[model samples]
Target: MNILMAIHIGAGLLALPAGTIAVAVRKGGRLHARAGTAFFGSMVVLGITAAILGPFREPEPLSPVAPLFVLYFVTTSWVAARRRDGSTGRFEILACAAALGTSAVMYWGVVMDGATTPAGPGVIYVLASVCLLAGLLDLNAILRSPLTPARRIARHLWRMCFAFFIATGSFFIGQQDILPAAWRGSPALLLLGFAPFAVMAFWLARVRLGKRLRASLQALPERKLA
Candidate 1:
């Protein structure tokens, strides 16, 4: 395993964080809107780069999963952004449900594979569901009240950030097959990516749930985030 390569790749992915922090610095400000464009642009660049080089660089399911995640992120991000008209339509609900259900299943899968993933995937799955449910409810509330508060938008921003964090972690773990067998169990070397793939799956589920949960909380009188 090229330890340097893994670190380099993971660190490079942090650009997404930079863009995210910028827009989420204070939701709804002109600067926030401007930074958001940059954040999306940066992610697009990262996704495209990963896609074009990912297949040759990494083999099997991991490579494909990366691109697929990118596509999902892009499409969903678009829906999340453009669908900001405050109306949660059938498509939105369908997409959220599918994403949430998938996360739930994935989490259960990891939990079943306890040998490799002791933490289980359900944690992530439930988290993603929370976000999704919250987002839906919040969207409805916003439609009625027509206001996306700073903290609320920041929570939304963090939800995506967390998702990206999980994806980046997966990229490292999924590449394990490429690592030297000796390096596989090297604590210092592999600690960061020891369970790369399962972690990603977990995060994917959590982030999606967070999306829904945020909506749910938004709609509630308490106005909290899950």
Candidate 2:
């Protein structure tokens, strides 16, 4: 493999399990923090290397867009975690703007491929749409002012999970050829690819429903006193 490809795979290897560990452990703990930092750092390197190598594949012009999308997602997601207080900073605004710009490029690519080229979207549509949605959400949060703690956590959780999903999908599904024959078509492989999404759904539900239920229960005694 070329140097860029090699670096991309190497960084992906580090990110895979580190991201998993970060998600599985208790949030805010030292272990989680360290693992998360490692995962984020690995993703940054992987995205950059992939972006570098993508354009070199002359026949596949759309190849470079995916890496740019990944970088945008990962960067914004990391920033969401940092801005826990719902405060908007320059970095957050810039990240959102970048994501929106990337989405526009992806949209143009897909349209051109469908209308003139043979590529026909090739996942760019879905990727671009996701970036668009995330960008809009980020912008909305910023414009609306301070986000609630729950909203902040929800944003952080979904964005991180989506970024992890991209990594898992690329490594486990896209690179399945490297796996042993027995493992290649296994259901376990499917689960591994989709586990990030499942976890994201569960956490989102908990943040919305579970927390609200707990808050109601805590307020019940005060209501009775009144």
Candidate 3:
């Protein structure tokens, strides 16, 4: 048990920096690919360990359920990156369904006894909301296949960043007690924790606009030729 816990923590620590580097570097380059690969591998390790260990935690069932959702999102987001336009696979459908079902269950738990839980219902509600939203987005993408390259990238970026956000939130805010006392509850820490989401949003807009400009530029020669 201790060994698994150590590995989970160690992998998570490695994943944080690797994921950050992946997000910062140029997209489609070898460096970005390698860093992103490393991040994904480390996250897989971290998620598996978390899911396995969660069930044994003092709180019993609820602990196990949380990590399962993490695994679901991480797996689906990774899959999204590899999918081509107009592709609709069984895995994607199943993953989206799992996300929706898990979110619903979490919400039910909140209604049942969330106030008595250590973390309270707020966290549960927030997580459920995001999972539900992500599931809906994934379903839309699947149903409306042949997504544009920019849109594909947008989906990949947001999903991966949201998964990254979960990791960051877990470490920075959820585990704040590990930090120096002065650093605890610092607004700076809060900003850093939420920075992934901001970056994701920036890139989402950037990719959409950049793709539109490139497409427009490409069409100009055809317009002139015609």
In terms of lDDT, which candidate is strongest? 2
Instruction: State the lDDT of candidate 3 residue by residue for 58-139, as single tens digits.
Output: 7444465556666776677677778765476898788889879988888887787654356666877887898899889879
Instruction: At residue 29, give the lDDT of candidate 2.
Output: 96
- The prediction achieving the highest TM-score against the true structure is 2
* Model 1 weakest 10-residue run by lDDT: 58-67
For each candidate, C-alpha RMSD in Å? Answer: 10.8, 3.0, 3.4
User: What TM-score would every model get versus the actual structure?
Assistant: 0.44, 0.88, 0.86
Q: Tens digit of lDDT per residue, candidate 2, span 160-216? A: 888899899887787789998778978888889989999999989988789889988
Angstrom error at residue 75, model 3: 1.7
Query: For model 3, where is the 10-residue window of minimal lDDT?
Result: 59-68
Looking at model 2, report the run of 10 residues with the lowest lDDT sum.
Answer: 113-122
> How well does candidate 3 score on lDDT at residue 170?
81
Tell me which of candidates 1 and 2 scores higher on TM-score.
Answer: 2
